[model samples]
Target: MTVRTTDTPVRVMIVDDHEVVRRGIVTVIDASPALTVVGEASTVDEARRRLPAVRPDVLVVDLQLPDGTGIDVMTRARELSPEQRMLVLTSFDDDAALRESRAVGAAGMLLKSARSRDIVAAIEKIAEGQTVWPSRPAEDEEELSATDQRIVELIGDGCTNREIADELGIAEKTVKNRITAILHSLGLQRRTQVAAREAARRRAGWK
Candidate 1:
């Protein structure tokens, strides 16, 4: 699956349907000394067919393909070469695409408008076995349902379950259930842990 893992240049293959975009990326890679462009494909079928031949260390893939989704290509490519790493290049701001890419074993997702340096760095990071997904803003973390947000904020303020339920005009049992679900979502065991995480996030200037 993987080629030599030593100090050799990281072999990269581009799978973009747009010819101009492919050339643009190739040009960027040309400027990076640690990378080598080994092949290019404009369609999912072509990428799947050529992946075995190229044996690239990283596959720089676009979300849209002439034949199928890039996730389709990544799935088949991983089946052919499980060690293959993928860096998704996408212009669409679709969160679903990011989720699908990770589900199918993509090592990173890069916006197409990213600076060439960022693209190169993401490639290197993926090649080094590190994830490179986009960071969600602090505001996005507060996107919980209004009730959930109120309950969690109260919990963070050290409000007891009965106190929160009483303040929010809800049953105490309902407050307990919501707290349990919040802990499960955050992979935390206690409300105090949630409070601590929120405190740390606040300290980090997340807001």
Candidate 2:
């Protein structure tokens, strides 16, 4: 992809199993005046190898990889540079990954279906030391069952009910039921509230 920018581009590393997805993201990166694609990787191994060389300011990583989970890459990146900004891009918006990513120091998480502008905006925000999350919030962990927790994660990751159901291999109706229970238990008006709560908890280092 060609980079078209005059701003001090936020150097980025793209990690995903799909070549076309990576290229598309690269195209977005290249088109953004504030971002640049420094490197791309199809798996954890390649990411590990190329990361040190690229030493990008931000990493746009997919949660699922052929060889290993993106968390492996996150850990490696942390070891290399604790300050490196990591933004997750995934099809499964599992709440567990969202919490884990935050606990492990990811700056942001976005769904694969997020608009190109939204993706670039997230990259820029992360580079500027700000966190960006999906509009839907996660439910309180204490108030959710294992299944509910999974649903919340997906919601926080920006997945629709159908997407969440597909990811968890459950019925969409089940997801709806779990969400209803979660709201009642947590006394939260909207899912975004859960996201806000999680964000605050992460900031306070309240695992």
Best candidate, lDDT-wise?
1
Cα shift from native, residue 117, model 2 (Å): 0.6
**Global lDDT of each candidate:** 0.81, 0.79
Model 2, span 29-60: residue lDDT tens: 89987888889999999999999999998898
Lowest lDDT 10-residue stretch of candidate 2: 135-144
Q: Could you say which candidate leads in TM-score?
A: 2
Displacement of the residue 135 alpha carbon in candidate 1, Å = 0.6
Give lDDT: candidate 2, residue 62.
Answer: 93
Candidate 1, 111-139: lDDT as tens digits:
99999999999998888888898887755
Clash number for every model? Answer: 0, 6
- Model 1 stretches with alpha carbons more than 4 Å out: 1-5, 137-207
Residue 13 lDDT (model 1): 95
- TM-score for each of the candidates: 0.65, 0.66
